[model samples]
Target chain A: MSELRTRMSAAIGTAPVEATRRGAERLAELRRRAETDYPPMGEMRDLARAIRLHTLANLHRYLSEFCESAQRAGTRVHLAADAAEANSIVESILRAAGARTVVKSKSMLTEEIGLNHALDGFRVTETDLGEFIVQIAGDRPSHIIAPVMHRTRQEIGRLFADVLGVAYTDDPPQLNDIARSHLRRRFLEADAGITGANFAVASTGSVVLVTNEGNGRMCTSLPPVHIALVGIERLVPSPAELAVLLEVLARSATGQRLSVYTTVVTGPRRPDEEDGPVETHVVLVDNGRSRVLASEDAEILACIRCGACLNVCPVYREVGGHAYGGVYPGPVGAVLQPALGVGSADLPFASSLCGACREACPVRIDIPRLLVGLRHRLVDRSSFSWLGLGLEAYSRVASNPTAWRLFLSLGSFGLRTAARDGWIGRLPFHASAWTAHRDLPGPGAPPFRVWWRNRNR
Target chain B: MSRLSEFLARIGTARLPSARPEVRAPQLDATDLVSLFIRRLEEVDGVVHRTDPVEVVAGLARRLGTDRYLSWDPDRLPVPGLVAELETLGIERHTGPGREEVPLGVTGADAGLAESGTVVLIAGPGRPRHPSLLPEVHVALLRVDLLHRSLTHWMLEHPQALSEGSGLIMITGPSRTADIEQQLNLGVHGPREVHVVLVGA
Candidate 1:
């Protein structure tokens, strides 16, 4: 809690002001456009939710179906039970191909597994600009969708100037040009490519990546060997369901009618095809998703990695993504941290429980409920702490009217020196944690029981 | 038990087993699909031109510059003599992952999405995936009849089409990125401009 409080307070000035502003504006525009552009978005979300729930309910069947279909379509499917296994599988695939240089698209699952840390011998390049920026800075992604959302343009310009030995320009198009020139060479020279899946259609054996930048296409097409690391929960039962997810994913993520490229690949390059990867490997990584699938918090598995929840979260807007201290951040990260046992247990308490995240979620995950559940598990399911001791003592007092009245009178008498203008400017001792940000009024009114008795008379 | 089997067994034990319900997407009926497609394409910063097959080729020749041009193989070309016509018009048609500096490239769409103005291209003998991408400007000649109501409708009708073992790329607009301060810069790493020439009126 100390560390969490420190990071959160530190994030006051560092929150992404411009990026969050732009995201908020774009999301409002998306909602307006969605009414006329697509069918009723609410009904569509219901369909999307049902589809995800169905897939999760029958995840094993769907995953197995995906494997069989992908194998039939000429992709070699490997099941990795954990992050270590997933990373090793990727390493072996690259090793067998004698891959020296590898180009990778932005994959959060890869970050979750710490894949880049294991590849000591290979030159790996992150093709996406946001991802490339983070990789160069030796930082993890702050926002799931916009990896470098926390960094301002000027900050990025300075970083580029310092690192890439190029002229600094805050101009986005110029920054884009610099990144394109930088990554274009990597794409050509790399022997293998890796990407994350937006949705995996089980019945069709297709790996779909919804991306605005064409880096996903480049990673899938340019290299001789392509390996896709897909979360097991990413699977959908059919192409029809894939369509449903795609409809909501882009609109929810960046508020686009469609992302620039939806690279739907069934397998590696076919016999008659000329350009795609020579050998394709599909790595199905559970990495704690199965545990989530079994848990009462299974609705969190309905996430499509859209980042809409992040956009609308009040606390995220204030504290920003880095404060979450995990591969994921925002409202979605708050749930995953506790669910996967990855990051701080204090994450669930980070939110205001406003339910904005649930409203913004495309699949309608009850994020606040999950947050409450985690909080309940943390306090009730643990050994006694100072707060617990205080609560136990207070419970005894609260149970007896005489003791409660006596305690309140003693507290009021003890606070006489601290009281000024019917308010305590700052609380004394451990209670200062509350008064640090807010002033506490000195017993402004009679206690509830006293007021109740007087009002009835 | 194998990890896969064990996972399935765990799923079997966890919670009340729910049936996988059939998901059907709501349909949007556009009185004029071609018009709807054009409007949607325009909204996404994609340019669209509607003309007859001859104009499709000739208009492509006229407006789209004839420099470092790459088109789908002869079989995938819309008209039989489109390749010859382009060559006659002094457009240099090359093959096989040309230098990264592709100025313009052409291909035909297997399906056109009216809902989002997406063009679906599948990798095959004539239609390699490279030409549609890599270039700064991509010219996709879509047949009017191939236009579908929505992506869902297309999938529902052609479920097996996905598992046909080809690289299918669905493009709604040119390659774009808003990652930097959420300011969108089109044609980042992929094509900068995508022009859909509706082959038939």
Candidate 2:
């Protein structure tokens, strides 16, 4: 078995299936609500897709334009070619500012680059409730939106009790209060704030953040210095373009017309401004995105990190996000990880190709087509594989009428011998793997070809 | 080439489409925008008070059972003499940095989006970000004329709203999170209750 298979099996064995199911169900409910609430859902999605594609196709122009405008607006823009470069740039920024404690909102880009691990000496705290829980537990986030989706309330309650020295209670609101009180102090005292941009408007040189909890606002406003790790692809030409994307983002992510807070930071605080970060740095991290853009699956960049595909995905619903073995999980992750050059080769084949992801995708990314295309690329690259050999053998037999008839007869006879009550409960060797999960129907006695001939006669 | 130039070079240009797609503003009949805005705001757990800003503020303070509150400077507010009204009502207005133990926050909105029940707030010197942020409860004084149909419409109309301030935030509802077992809990780090006092509605 591959490493991904081993991790998936382990996750399936240990991760609570009930919690994941409930999370998926809740996401489905929210998605349905969002679709119903936004009557122009389809039209907005088309506009969003067009905007994303246009931005990507003309990324060079927009990126340069954004950097110039950001600089003009008093934002120091840094371009990092890879994860290491990005992490180092952030570290140097912190070091220069003499920042001791850092409060951060939920930023997948920071996770992808492993920022916390790099900032070992500095007191880094995740301010977002979900991310804070993940920080305390010393665990990886299972879901993109709801990081602790796999964790139960009781588990979190105990984690707070053990870590924060608070009394145990599974009540969500009470738990929220505890985090609010604890992190509020961190927000006040923290030397710097770090965040990820949902979209960067090139024209005005602004970073857009969408969040329901308002932690995004807290992170951007409370700290003296702010650093935003933005993926190169997270850009729109103007607020007009941003408006279109924002319309669909929350609805697609959590089924809200708008998140509780949608903040647009143009730059560091103005001299006359009483509050907000005095120093702002927008680090544009490439981190294999250019590689992805060069690949056949470039459309994956169009994703807004909504995680809608994860909710509707049947496979993800079964095994949960940990099984995908990456920062991003579910259908988007399957294509994205490999495209980013960080995933197992079998990641593409992990899907059922139901096209539910494509359907759920607000950007209308053809995920199924991308998965198939990746599989094709994998096959072409590999020298040998059981799948390739099996296909080669089947093709030779299938092309010749006599060989095809003999192969079918042999397969039918073998299946017939194994059948009990006209159902093959188990089969010997590798075929038993299929029967282990579900029973297979025995081949008919007259066979389909013979039955067709008889019916015609 | 510099690092930025090198990075940009990696992302080579593609054939551009002749025309970019345009996003249409949400259709809202002029007569019903205020009512529609109220309903949408209510749906998101925000309270909408249709009355004079002064009475709304006084009522909200009384309802919350608090005498002291934080707010934007008087001149920045849409309603004239709001501070005087609060003072007359014996509502103590707290000012200066550090909003500790403040129960309610009042401010003026830049614009009100009817489609999503959103209030756009721009950060400035007198207009601190935390009055609406750090407090447990927040109230905004929005004039009827500032209301727009949607974010798209608002952006199309007020392009300079993006560049005029250091930052702008569009608040739809109170702060909420569904992180714990996908069970939503309000007021995680920001205000739990958001009230929009629509003046001259």
Candidate 3:
């Protein structure tokens, strides 16, 4: 908790956070647009969830079928049990293709598997403009959709000038055009392209990629060899279901009715097609997803990665994506990171359990409930902690009415020095850690039980 | 165990509740398809030629600075005498390959979606993916009869429409991005201008 608070405190004021605030604005607009665009939003979310549940339950069958169909479509399918295997496979494919340089579209799966770090010998450039900025600035993505959302234009301009030896300017068009001209050369010269799938259909061996910049299209088309590393869980049944997912994905992510580009790449180029890649390889990566699938909190596997939960989460907006300290951040990240690593147990506690993430989630994963579950598991798995003991005693006291009333009255008297005008300016004990950042409301009135007794009199 | 076998062993074939919940998403509320298609198309900064004779394309072409023209098969073109008009306009037309140097590209879409104003492109003979992609200006000739109501309608009726090709795309708006500080820009890689000429069947 001290570590998280220090990191979050360090992020304050120095970070512009305009992008995250705009992202939150974007999410509210998404809800309105979804209501307008998809019409019956509630029914659509329910149906989307049902589809995900059915697919996850029959995951093995669907996965086997997907492999078969992809093989039939002339795509070589490779399975990775862990990140090392996935990285080695990617490297092997590049080596076989004799690829020295690779252009990549933004893919969280690659980030999850730590692919960029593993590709030590090869030259890899992130093709998306925001990703390119982060790559040059030597930073990881702070937001999923807009990676450099936390940085100021002035900062980015300085990075570009220092790295690329260009004139410094904060103009968006100039920066975009700078990235455009620079990446165009890379696209033409790179030997292989790597991307992540928004959805992979089992019935048909097609990979659906949705992007606004059309960089995904460039990465797939301009290169000679294409490799798509997909998390095993991002699969649905068919194109019919792909339509349903796309409907929510666009509105939920950027508030667009549909993104500018929704591409379906079946496989490598056909016998006579002039463009597209000559060879296609799909790496089915299951670093920790299979573990997630088998766990009790398996419903989280249904996420579409629309990032709506992150955008609307108040905790996420203030502290920003970096505070969570995981490949995936925000509410989904908090629930998801613990399943991957024991070290990430602190992530789940990062949420306020506000239920906003659950409300915003298109699939309705019940994120707050999962965070509570993670808290419970933390107690059984790890050693003694003050939170566990405090919560344990508090719950016991909370259930007993007589004990609870007495506890509240004693708390008011104990907090009188910090109390003024119904708010606590500071708190005593280690609990003052909370007040170090934000003020807490004082025990303003008498206990409800006493107030009720006085009213009756 | 092989990873697949290990995974299969861990994950048994448990039949979840059947997912056929009747979620009715009926978005084809527009009785008039052309107006709806044009309205949706225009909303996305796409130009639609709905007037008679399809000569309205000539006006749309005026803005594009058509120095050289590269298009799909001449047989598939819905704009009557378009090639002759290009010749008369002193524009050089080249039809060779992908990654060409032409500025204006013309092609025929297999279908146009009305709900989202998307053009569905399926690759085939004379449709060498480049005409719609590599050029700065993309002018697709759409036959009115080929416009579909929505993705749902297309999926139920023609599920194999996209799967049969090496690549299939449903391009809605022009190639764009808001990647730099969330400021929208057009023509990052694909065609900057997307104009559709809707001709009578």
Candidate 4:
């Protein structure tokens, strides 16, 4: 079996069914509410797509503008060419500040770069409730938006009991209170906080963060030092463009007109300010984004990490996110993983090409087209394979009428003999791969050409 | 080459599509913005109270059921004589950060977005981010005139609002989460209850 298939089967076998059902229901409810709340949703998506594409096409100009404006606003901006460089720069920042305890809001970029592992000696706590639970349980987040979507309340109740020495209870609000009291203390005492930017406005030199929970605000506001790990592609030209993207992001992500908190942090706190971080650092991590920018699949960079595609994906619904085995999951992950050169070659073929993701995407990414393009690229890269040989031979025969007719007749004969009650329950040898999952339809007794000839008689 | 230059050079200048898309703001009844704001805010689990400025402040203090609360500086609030009103109600206000035990936190909003029922709060010397964040219940005092149709409308009118402070936050409702078994839970990390007092209404 392929590695993807194995992981998928394992995920399907183990993932709590009730949790997945509940998560899907909630997502459906949100999507329904979003349609009513935002009346001009289609126009908003077009505007968002245009803004993202324009930003990427002119990234250098905007990035330079962003760095200069950020510096002038008292934010220290660092440029990292890769993950190693990004991690080292963050380490130095923490080292200089003598920060020992760090609280982090949900940042997939940090997870991508493995920032926590680099800070071996320092105490790092994931402050977001979902992320906090994922941290203490020593697990990777399964979903982009809702990290612990696969875990049940009962399991979380047990995790809290086991990890925090608290009594076990399956009620969600009580569990939330326990985490709230615990993380609140960490928020007040943590030396530093790190978060990811949803959108970084180039004109104002501000990092925009959207979150339903206020942990994003808590992390950026309370700590003495704040570090934001931003992907280079996260830049928007100005607040006007930022507004367009924000209009679609929350609605697409969780079906809200806006998240509970949408924060825009321009720089460190002023000398007279009583709250907010004393020092702010913005790390622009390019980790292979330029390569993606110069590729045919550059539009994948326009994705806002909304996970709307995942909610509507049939394949993701069946196997869940952990099967994809990447920081990003679902249809977007299939294209993005290979685009970033981090995923297996088979990731692109993990979809049914349903076109649901394209419809659901707020930025209107043509994910199906990108998936097919990646599949073509993967086939071109391979020098020799059974699939390649078979396709080459099949194409030659398909072009020749006589050979095509002969091959179809032979195939029909073999399929007709194997049919039991007009259904091929199982086939012999390598063809059984299809029968293993589903029965194949029996071919007609007379081939299509023969039937055509007989029809005229 | 510097790191920034190297990064920029790799993202080389290529002739790219440059058509900027324009977004048309939805038509809204300007005279009825206050009602729109109230309804939108209520949709997201936020409370709206319509009362005169001074009466509202006193009412909030009295209903808080606690002596001490966090707040932004009185002079920055929309209502005049807020400090006197709170004093009359005997409510002790902590303007600085680090008072986590305070049950209520009150502040004046920079602007209120009618489209999403969002209140924009900018952080500055006298206006800290804590009052709106740290307490169990957050009460925002918004003037009727400060309400705008949406985020885009507000940005187009007040572009410099982004540059005025170290940070600005648009809070639509109270802090909430649905991470545990996808069940909705309020007040995970921030205030559970958010109340907006329309001063001029």
Can you tell me which runs of candidate 1 are displaced by over 4 Å?
A: A15-37, A386-389, A444-457, B1-17, B52-66, B96-99
**lDDT tens digits, residue span A409-433, model 2:** 8888888898998999998888888
* lDDT per residue as tens, model 3, A100-147: 999998899998888988998999999888888888888988887878
lDDT of 4 by residue, A269-328 (tens): 998888999999999998988989988888999999998898888888888878898799
Model 2: CA > 4 A from native: A10-15, A416-423, A441-457, B14-19, B27-31, B63-66
DockQ of 4: 0.72
Q: Sort the predicted structures by TM-score, highest score first.
A: 2, 4, 1, 3
> What is the two-chain DockQ of model 2?
0.68
Q: Candidate 1 at residue A289, lDDT? A: 81
- Give the per-residue Cα lDDT of candidate 1 at B36: 89
- On a 0 to 100 scale, what is the lDDT of residue A48 in model 1? 89
Fnat, model 4, is 0.76
Off by over 4 Å in 3: A383-427, A434-457, B1-3, B10-28, B51-66, B76-81, B95-100
The local lDDT score (0 to 100) that residue B172 gets in candidate 2 is 94
Top of the candidates by DockQ: 4
Model 1 residue A144 distance off true place after TM-score fit, in angstroms? 0.9
> Between which residue pairs do clashes occur in model 1?
none
Clashes per model (N, Cα, C within 3 A): 0, 0, 0, 0
DockQ of each: 0.64, 0.68, 0.53, 0.72
Local accuracy by lDDT, each model: 0.82, 0.89, 0.79, 0.88
